[model samples]
Target: MTDLVIRNATVVTCDPAGTVIADGGVAVRDGRIEQVAASVELEAAAAGARRLVDGKGHILMPGLINTHCHAGDSLFRGLVEDLPLEPWLQTVWKAEGAILNPETCYLGSVLGFAELLLSGVTTVMDMFWYPEETVRAARTVGMRVSTGGIFFDPPGVTGDNLKGRIAAAERFFEMFSDAEDVFPAVLPHGAYTVAPENLKTAKQLAERHGALFSTHAAETRAEQADVTGRYGRSVIRHLDDLGLLDERTLLAHCVHLDDEEIQILARTGATAVHNPVSNLKLASGFARVPEMLAAGVRVTLGTDGAISGNDLDMWMALRLAATLHKAVTGKADAVSTAQALAMMTSAGAEALGAAGRIGSLEAGKLADMILIDVKRPHAVPMFDPVTHLVYSTARSDVRHVFLSGEQVVRDGALTRHAIGQTIEAVERLKPRIAASIA
Candidate 1:
């Protein structure tokens, strides 16, 4: 018998052709999509399905993919505010030093991943101090995560030296080498915080493991100036000079890139992840998203972290991504709705090198999808489902979510884990978190 069947809904395939079925659903067997067809076409399968979900009054689409985030930093939401990237990070690090440990990191990651999973983000590329804890939290919340050891020059949260950091990164690869849900990566904090040789070492580890190398790059003018002063080149150029730009590289926040840098990214096939909410909140300048997209740079989306964004809301990210550039560039269509949506879906999966497994609704792909309720007042009279998702849908509209054919979230609540305990735990630590910077 089929494992599960969901019928009677609007299916937004998010495929290259952008196929949408007006009244259709999907069949899942052995944790993979068996078929995606009209409700009428799925009747025979539904008859013998182990479980059937009637997705009436909903739009089913592929789950969102967050290409960049610090999930554990959710513990510091709204703690250090009204500062730019440089000073802001210093305060943030001070707080992290005081309160972050493996246990707390896991707690905070659970809090953050709960928010992401509840809002239809099935996969996330998160950077945090405790990558094992990050993976633990993702598993507890029943979501996919891409994370590994962190690389920082100074004694950060883990306080590991260069040799210790290398060992930790390699150990991470060994631990999760077979984990289907964990995508291993080596995350150096940024060019400003990590030495050039350390950055190269991190890249080497990633290359050796065939994992991703992610770091903050040119998120602000100060960062660009600092990197250029240190290396005599801008952030992207410095990375290229070190031979670190490639298809496996995930660069967060190319907000201050020049025209030549944009060309370099396109030529190297590195993905640039845009965190609009955090960039705006921290007063970082707008990313040249339109120029990058036009240059054929594979652009993706991220929430950054709740610490900077004040929340992990990919819908807000999606809406801002779809609309923000238009206002900045003085063009009504600077970024199209589909392009913005792709940044969180296909582009994200591509960035993680999991394009064939996730990202869109298709036969033989993992059953990672979400159902958005269109019964809301704002979602009514939807002309285009994609437009509605981009401009109208809210996180609260995500009523059901499936990861690998398992019902991780049902009726807007997590099924694998209860979040009330996590909330209470964070609330207890709120005072300590506030006092860290004080």
Candidate 2:
């Protein structure tokens, strides 16, 4: 018997073949996709369904994947404003985020996860401090996450100061490596924040465990010029020299990568996560997605942080990525709707090393999906569902979200757990908001 069934929906698998199963029904059992076919076929295939959801006039697709973010900064959503990366990091954000307690980080992760689930994001690649808090929050919310545990020396550690950070990561891995939905990774902050030697240590430890090593590289022109000035190589090349750029490395915000750097990323099979809203808001450069895609690089989408993006909205990231690619390249045929959908879905899953598990609406994959209200006004004149999702529809239109075949969101409201208390707790934190802003 199927645990739950969704009937009469336009199913977009976003599979490699770009399959769109129109007039389809989904059979889910034990938190996995059992079958996807016409309603009659689904009914016959699963004779007994504990619960069946009528998906008439709805679009069913894989849940969105937000591949990179700072879940530790949710409380500071609007604190860092009207400043570039240097000033924002040097002044407002760094000072604030660097001091977040485990409790604050937990609250922030919970809030961020809630927002992502509301916007149909089933998977997240979160890089932050106090990750045990993030893991606990993920468990509570029942959201899948790739945890990029921070491994950097404190403000001033001169020589070979990696033991403490590495120990922390090892402990994290040991604790949560067997977790059902948590994937632990080693994350060095960025080229500027972390020294070359520390990057090498992080790479070694990450490679030792075949774990994902994430970092912010080549985010701005200043960051770009400084790296090249010091090493006579691009930022990506420098990381490569440290043995950091590999299939196990996830480089976020490769906005200033040159053509050769793009080639290196493609050659190394490393993943790139483009943070368009954060880049735009911070006045950071747009990642060369057209060139990156042309070079066969696997690119995914991310919402950097609520502090930078002003909201934990992956839908905004998807729309910004599609439009930003076109606006910058001045070509209408750039970053196809299908490809954009892939980036937010299967490509992100692949980046997190969970390709066949959650990114696509396929049989045997974990049943993480969302039902879009196709009848909405902005979603009208329904020429192409992909384009509508990318260009027209807002995050508010997410009517339902599912994780592991369970209805986490129903009728545009969270149903898996009680979120009102979390929201209220965040609101109560208003007393401390002044300190962050100050």
Candidate 3:
């Protein structure tokens, strides 16, 4: 018997051919998708399902993949604002240094993951301090997370220095070697905070253990100039020189790249995560997403952090990405609805090196998906499902969420934690967090 079956939904299968089923059904067994067909076809196939869901008036699609974020900073949302990357980082880092511990990190992650689940995000790639605590929080909430055991000089939470950081990552990999939901990576902060030698070491460790390596790059003009002054090259070129640019590398905020730098990213096969909302909120320049996609570069979507994005809402990122590029390039066809959807789904899966897994609703892939209520005021008069999904849908439309065949969200409420208690817990920490900064 199958674990769960969802039937009678508008299934937007983000497959290679972009198939959309009017009345589709998906069966899940052993945490993997068993079948995807019309409801009439799957009725008998999933006749013995342990759980059956009526997905009427819902848009079913793959769970949104958040390619990059600093999830532990959720508690610091709006704490320090209206500043660019440099000053913003300075203040946020201080707040992190003052009160960051395993417990606080867990609380912040729980807060962030809960928000993500409500917004239809199931998988996230987080680069932050105290990642062990973050891992624990994700597990508790049953969210899929690909995060690094991060390190920096004058380390933030995990260790003291680069050496200490590598040791901690090794231990983390060992501890979570068989983890089904958590994928461990080796993440250095960036070229600005970490030396070239440390970046190389981190990449090598990631390669040795077969994990992901990621960091921020070219988020601002000041960052580019600093890297050029220090190394006589841009950050991308410098990382390439250090042998850190590869298929495994995921760069966040490639917002200020020139033509040559964009070519370098394409040639290196590195993935760039476009954070349009965060970039705009921070007054960072626009990323050349249109050019990147045209050059055959794999581009994905990210929400950066709740502090920068004001919320971990992928719908904002998707809608802004789909619409903002048109205004920037003065062409209405700049980033298509299909392209924007791909960036969060199939393209995101490819970027995270999980193309065979959770980004699509294929038969063998993991059953990570969300059901959005489409019989709402904003989503009414639906012409194209993809267009409505990209342009009109809101995060509040998410009705149900599944991770590995298990229902983590049902009817806009979290199944793992009490919403009132979660909010109250964070409210209790408000005084201590504020006093630390004071």
Candidate 4:
């Protein structure tokens, strides 16, 4: 029997051809999309489906994917503000050290994932101290997550040594390697924080398991100078020299890259995750996204974390990804609306090696998608759905979110868990969070 059917909406399938179906919806069976066609074409399926959703006055599209985020850091939002990445990170670490445990990490992860899921993000690649807790929190909120053991030189939240980090990463693969909702990865902090040997170890572990390897790279000029002083090369060159750049590698914030570095990313097939809001807030210079896109590099989008970005809003990221470059480059057409939207959808799935499964709305892909209400004042008179999605749609317009045909978020609220309790818990922890850096 057909599991579910959604009809009577405009479907913005982020497929390679960019197919848009007016007055269309989708049918699902066994958690995968059975068909995506016009409402009239799906009338027969809707009649037999166990559940039917009317998507009137809405734009149905594949759910957004966030390629880089520190979800647990959501606990420290607005606590350590007005500092650059270097000093800001030191103070942030201080707060994390004082407060973060498995339980607290779980709470923060749930809070961050809740915000993302509600905002139409079905999957996120989060790097935090506790990978197991991250997965547990994602499951609680019924969303997909890509995370694994964290690699840091100093005693971070888990206080794990190099050996401990390796063991934990392996254990993570053992646990969730087969989980449909979990995309396991090994994430080191950054080139500046982790030693070259340690970074290579993380990459090797990821390669051995055929999982993802991600880290912060070239986010600031100071970061470039620091890495050059130590490694005798720029951050991207250093990583490339170490043979760490590849299809499975996700490099966050390639903001300080030269033209050659951009080509290097294209040649190596590594994905660059742009956290525009976090970069702007921290005063890290703008990334060469337009140039990278031109170079055939796969650039994706991310909401770094609430601590840096002040919110986990991919819509804001999408808007910035679409409009920020045009202003910076002085060319009104620097980044196209479709390109910006692809960064949050298909490009993100490609970054995680799940492009075949969850990126687009097509027959046989997972039914991980969202519906945005276009009846809003700002969304009226939509000329192009992609343009509306990139320029006009807000997180608040995400009326429904589905993951594998399950309604994880209905009416803009989480179905598996209530966010009120998470908010209240964070409220209780607010004083301690503020006092940590004081």
Candidate 5:
């Protein structure tokens, strides 16, 4: 017998051919999709389902995947804005040192996950120090999280030394190796923070453990110059020489790649995660997404962190991604609605190494999906669901969210804990967070 069945919805199957089914339904058995067909067909097939959800007048699609983020950085939202990458890093690092701990990390992660889940993000790739705590928070809210111990040499931080951080990362990999909803990764802060030798070691560790290797790369001109001055080559070249460029690598930012660098990424099969709103907010230059896509580099989208991104809404990023490149290149077809949707959905799942299982709404994939209410004013007069999703849909339009066939968000609210409690927790920490930076 199936666990749940959702019927009478516009099912958008983000498949290889972009299939859409009107008045369709989905059957879920044991947390995986059992069938996707017309409502009448599923009514006959899914008769044994324990629960039935009426999805009438809604758009049911795959859950959005956030490819790169620092979930613990949500606590620092608006704490330090209007600054470029370097100065912003200095301020954030200080704030992290002063106020960051396991408790606070969990709180910030809960806050971030709550925000993301409300906005239709089911899977998130987070790079933070207290990964175990983050995982705990994710579990509390039913989020699929990819994370691991972070490697960086900033003073006043635990594992401030490379050796200590690597040791911690090894421990994390073993601890979370068999975790169900968690994907272990090795996250070095960046080329600018980590030495070449250490990056090579981290990459080797990730390879040995069969985990994803992620890091920030080439987000700013200043970063490029610094890496060039130190390594006598671009940051991408240095990483390539260290054997860090591979299919398992997920590079964040990548907002400043040249033609050669783009070609290198394509050749290595490494994924570049574009953070459009964050890039524009930080005044970081735009990534050559059109060039990268044409060159065969797999590009995905991220909101970065709540602070620089201002919010964890993928709809905002989706719209910006759909429109920004066109505005910059004067080409209306720079990124199509389909391409933008793919970046947020399938490309993100591919980057997370969960493509075969979760990105698309297919028969055999896990039942991770969202129901967007199209009966609203902004979404009215909908001609194309893809266009409406990419251009008009808002996070508030998310009516229900599911992960592993379980409803975690219903009627626009979290299922487990009260969001008001999360807000209160963060509000209580605000004074200390402010005092730390002050």
Candidate 6:
């Protein structure tokens, strides 16, 4: 018997074919989709369903995917903004460098996960300091997470620290390896933050365990100039020279790549994650997604984090990604709604290394999806569901969210705890974080 059934859904499957079935129904059993058929067909197929949600006036689609984030930075939202990457990392965001303890990491992850779940992001790729704390927060909040411990060339974290970092990452993986909610990966911070030697070491570590290696690529003009000036090659070319761009690499930002870089990414089967809002806020140029697509590069979307984006809302980022490419290239057909959907869905799943399991509404795929309240004023007169998703919808329209067939959000509210609870947590942390500022 089916455990739950949702009927009367305007099903917008973000599949390759982009099929939209009106008055559709989905049956869930054992954390997988059992059937997707007409409401009457589903009702007749699954007798004695334990629960039924009348998904009237709702658009049911796979949950939005956030391919890159710094969960530990959410608490620092608005703490540093309107600054370049180098200056922001050096000064205003310096508090995190010193003050980010286990408690702060967990608090920030909790806060970040709360915002993400509410905004219809069911899964994320996190690069943060405290991997254990990130797992704790994702487990507590009931969201799917793929995180990697950071590797950088700081005075404190040397080549010797790689051993301990790898150990910690292994411990995290072993502890949560069987848990469906948390998946572990390794993260190399960025091109300028870590030495080339460290990047090589990180690749070896990831290869040993057959894991994904993610890093920040050319996300800003300064980074691009710094890399070229230092290495006499573009950032992507340098990575290619070092054999870093491969099937396992997930490069974040990717704002300043040329046609050669695009070809490298395409040939290497590497994934590029676009953070439009964060890039724009930091005055970073728009990603050449259209060019990248033509080059066959797999592109996905991410919110970056609250520290950079001021919100863990993927909906806003997806919209920005949909429009910014067209606006930047002066081509109306730059990024179509279908391409935007792929960026926010399957492409992100591929980045998170869960491509076959989630990111779509396939029968065998994991039951991860969101129900948008299409009854809203702005959601009315929906000519095309995919178009409405990119051009018209807001985060507030998310009515119900699920991860692995379990409801994490319902009635447009989080299911884990009360808003009052999150507010109290944030309120408490606000004063402490503010007081710690020097």
lDDT of 1: 0.94
For residues 86-176, write the lDDT of model 6, one tens digit per residue.
Answer: 8887754456755677877888888898888888988888888777788878877778888766687673322337677667667666776
lDDT of 4 by residue, 1-438 (tens): 899999999999999999999899999999999999999999889989999999999999999999999898889888888999999989999999999999999999999999999999999999998899999999999899999989999988888899999999999999999999999999999999999999999999999999999999999999999999998999999999999999999999999999999999999999999999999999999999999999999999999999999999999999998899999999999999889989999999999999999989999999999999999899889999988999998999999999999999999889999889999999999999988988
Rank the models by lDDT, top first.
Answer: 4, 1, 5, 3, 2, 6
lDDT of model 6, residue 393? 89
Better of 1 and 5 by TM-score: 1
- The 10-residue segment of model 6 with minimum total lDDT is 153-162
Better by TM-score, candidate 4 or 3:
4
User: Could you give candidate 5's per-residue lDDT for residues 315-412 as a string of tens digits?
Assistant: 99999999999989999999989989999899988888888888899988999999999999888899999999999999999999999899999999
**lDDT at residue 126 of model 1 (Cα atoms):** 94
**What is each predicted model's overall lDDT from 0 to 1?**
0.94, 0.83, 0.89, 0.95, 0.90, 0.82
TM-score of each: 0.99, 0.95, 0.98, 0.99, 0.98, 0.96
> What are the clash counts of all predictions, listed in order?
0, 0, 0, 0, 0, 0
TM-score of 4: 0.99
Looking at model 1, the pairs that clash are none
Whichever of 2 and 5 has more TM-score, that candidate is 5
Q: Which has the higher lDDT value, candidate number 2 or candidate number 5?
A: 5
- Show model 5 residue runs off by greater than 4 Å: none
Clashes of 5: 0
For model 3, residues 1-438, the per-residue Cα lDDT tens digits are 889899999999899889999999799999999999999988886679888999999999999999998887898888888899899888888888887888888889888988988899999999877788888888777788998668586656544776678878898898886788877788888898888888888899999999999999999999999989999999888988898888888999899888888898899999999999999999998999999999988999999999888899999999999999999999999998999999999998898889899888999999999999999989889878999999999999999999998899989988987767767888998987787677
Please estimate how well model 4 matches the true structure, expressed as its whole-model Cα lDDT.
Answer: 0.95
Give the per-residue lDDT of model 1 (tens digit) for 1-438: 799999999999998888999999999999999999999999999999999999999999999999999989999988888999889988998999999999999999999999999999999999998799999999999999999989999989998999999999999999997888988999999889999899999999999999999999989999889889988999999999998999999999999998999999999999999999999999998999999999999999999999999999999999999999999999999999889999999889999999999999999999999999999899889889999999999999999999999999999999999899999999999999889988
Clashes of 6: 0
**Segments of candidate 6 deviating more than 4 angstroms:** 155-160, 435-438
